[model samples]
Target: MPHPERNPFVFSDARFRKFIGSVAAIGAAALVLVGCSPSTDQGGTFADDGCTSVVVATSSEKVNLMEDLGAAFKDSAEHKGLEKCATVHAVNVASGKAAQYLSDSTTEWALGADTAPSVWSPASTVWTNRVASIAGDKVVAGAESFAKTPVVFGMPESMAKALGYPGKPISLKQIHDLIANPDGWGAAGKSMWGSFKIAKTNPNSSTTGMSMLLMQAYAASGKAQDLTVADVKAAEEFSRVFESGAIHYGDTTGKVLQNLADRTSGKGSSYVSAIALEETSLYNYNIGNPDSHTVQPGETLTPPDEKLVAVYPSEGSMWSDNPAVVLDAKWVTPEQKTASAAFVKFLHTKKAQELLPKYGFRPTDDSVDVSKYLNADVGVDPKQPAVTLPQPEPEVVSAAIDQWAAIRKPSAILQLIDISGSMDESIGDGRTRLDGAIEGSTATLGQIRPTDEIGVWAFTTGLSSNIDGTRVNGIGVVRPFGVLGGDKEGLQSDIEDLANSQRAGTPLYDSISSAYDYMKTHAEAGRINAIVVLSDGEDTDSATRLDTLIQKINADQKEGGNDKPVRIFAIAYSKAADVESLEKLARASGGQVFDATDPAKITETFQSVMNNF
Candidate 1:
């Protein structure tokens, strides 16, 4: 039932031959799980019933599908034959985060499921390979493809037509050239479309971003496979050119797609010309479900007026062979392993494979037809991805990530912290809301390169002047913008001083408007120019109205044809925080808002926001 010809994991390189061989052995075993009655246990532990409890930690995109399959498998004769031996739980975990958790022994696996996973199925084997390289071979012994989707450039239908898509394949080199050209879409004779902007996620945190990085490096080396460390080094300049076109980076692609969908609804020009996404993601976007979350029954789906079509690179692209990997960890019991294998076998059945296409995924079992779902109606081609770039050695993949860090666009960030009276309220563990925020902000400094430009501002009503004797306003410049390499210590000190600087009343509107204007005036080219706002309450003192501030942000975003748009990334720090206003401000400026209502999670939320830079 397996389609060898359609399989993209076939490796010709000697380095990965053994790995591929092991994968085949695993696949042949049909190792998976079968569902049973739901457990009424806490902390991801199995109820002390006679059945084995198998936990499958999967990437977020496949959680619903896996859950459905598990539910269906519960009633099968195969499960009944085993006397309901196993109860399976599918939990959502980001691929990159899962790899990080497995790599670090001390890190607790508190990702939704409180217990460590018996099996880990990330989006691609790339993650499994990374885990193996860092945590040792014993961590991820082997993995097999469960479903497949190729990385692609999701572009508006009109834009794809202009680039000769469908009629001709678009190569990565062509995309790089377009990104480097100051003329933007003018090179394609569509000046009205404006500059060529792209939305790319942080490679360290996203599978699509990792695939994009690898493919771009391979394209630069002029090789279809067998990429080397030298090739990645040689492609630094090329990578920089392509990265320069990015409007911003995030931990996930959902934000990018959601932004595009929002623009479509508003009947405005798309925020970005293209976004790096999986083929399934493009299909979902075409159908107006850009976030690709499982649509609930009775939910009305509205297709976007402007659909996004997939452009498989002629130079060759990569596939996310959603590999189901049974972890070889001490935590996994033999019984759980057996149940895991059974679950994977159930996934390969015709019934299970048939459901994959309905969700915009290609079945790993080639016998399952995909033509019905992957068609022009959904902005995808069933026969696509004729050529897949070979998987490089794990070392090469690691080196590419390092090279990306060096060549990726730097950021210019101005952080605004609310020092209102409410910030003094205790969150828990003897820490105030301000204390948690400061901790998160301080930690964020280490996440960015020293070459980045950084500054800080503290705001509260009646704040007339700063430590630097700056002019009067509702806010004070705790630290002026400077190269982070030189001002790291001073910035840290300024942030610490904020704990003692709490004052009465929040001047939210005035602070954001002033910060926005300042950032726009000093916006740097070849970097992410933006403001980061962390607030714990609504505006209590400000001359500027919310509507007036939004209008100013909109006007600035549209100015100079948006050549240097300054984005505003806001974090609502507590339930009392004004989330709706923050969302509007962030959306207007081409940035996204983060919800941190639970102050205890501020540290995690802050790091996520920093990934944008």
Candidate 2:
């Protein structure tokens, strides 16, 4: 039990500096994997007359800053007479993306935003430490705070008044209590001393959003003043409010920010505000439409706080660690590696550091005046400075996220698998699509317990169970669309049994619709509900057809599943597989699609289904 150095692909290698020096492309690739990708075609690999280019891998937010930052480095690249240059292809590589990238050995460096790569950007110190831990004992890497602002509780002025505005720092205890005992808040609707709402991400993604939940868990459980599993379960009290079945799946920082402007979303709700939100988002929100319907105000708990104040959870909060490292892949050159290092150094220079104000970033240099950037820049009040956070061992934290997942809420799921023709093709290593499907299905089953429910439906010869159709037999029955039934144990048996009895052809369409039908029938809000569909090929057999089911799924994602508008995630198996169709199905259900042959990646696919449910 010392923290395993295995680095769960999401993040690997405790030592930061040396790793980058070893692989230039690794970092850049990590960015891509995490959904923080920068576009290419800006510059080519090797420039004329010995100039070379290396990939700067990192998250989109950091990648967004690359244009200006990268360009500035371009000037230095020319000035230093260095033959190589660095171009950032902002791969959307987040922590989860990092694991994939490292496993595959792509990209140059893994650049992140917070000091601690795992959580939100509490302050410069927190970001620095996590990256250091990620870099481990040897690498001498330092976090350069380019810009920063405190995370403010963006509540209406009225809500602030209800919570005792302008009082000492908001007590985390109050927030935890609200989540732990939402019923209490209901009785005291006018409760003013301290008002709070739950802020969370799906835990599978959104490091910062997860941070908010963890802090609360620690406070609620009170197992230790320092962060621990006990504290996390206690903080899970926030999920209690969700048990009412209110929280939506996969609402990250961006969505939460949008919800903040809408006051009607009563009681426990709000995002930790940042300075550099999407420029166009704020512009549009402030502009309002012709009817000005969006430009309405509600009884604010605290009138929109003018100056930014990052409320460090009184019990303590977590920080985000965004590190800029180089992957140093075979494609990289020594010149490119040096350029990457110089680029990082440039970010700390006066010109780049000055950007902290306008961009809503807090400067790492203490000497600079953060206040000057207040209104003129992002309107982030200069009063706040970067906060320092404790760096808990990564292993303990990983376990915390799991415990958080458990105590939060139970999930209900329906597996809508496509039994089409292409499942017949041989994947690499002599495995068929169905073989992989069975592997994934088997793995998914082992993870589920009684609290979780799963159902199975195999489509090929007919809509009934793949085996002999026995009414309510241990195996689930297939219907018109792709739907299944029963608890975890029951569902697992059905899926495994269905795998055993699958015919040569895959009935993709029928499977999808049937699975969807189950969700509609059993639709319950508190239960995390979804239907994960997999098709090795196209929909050959389906009385209803895949197109019709897709349209219905699309309509549902935009509008919440009233009874159970199931979120659908899909896995496109094999090389010739119809990824487009699979992707379309997933998007309709607010899920994403995956290519089965590529690295046999089920991380995103499996994660999407589990997290959404």
Q: Assess every candidate by TM-score.
A: 0.88, 0.62
Stretches of model 2 off by over 4 angstroms after superposition: 1-50, 77-83, 97-136, 139-199, 202-206, 217-318, 326-337, 355-361, 365-399, 443-450, 466-510, 523-525, 536-565, 572-604, 611-613
Question: Candidate 2, after superposition: displacement of residue 75 in Å?
Answer: 0.8
lDDT (10s digit) by residue, model 2, range 106-153: 233323221111111212233333444564422324434444334333
Candidate whose lDDT is highest: 1
lDDT (CA) per prediction: 0.78, 0.44
Whole-model lDDT, model 2 = 0.44
At residue 169, candidate 1 shows an lDDT of 90
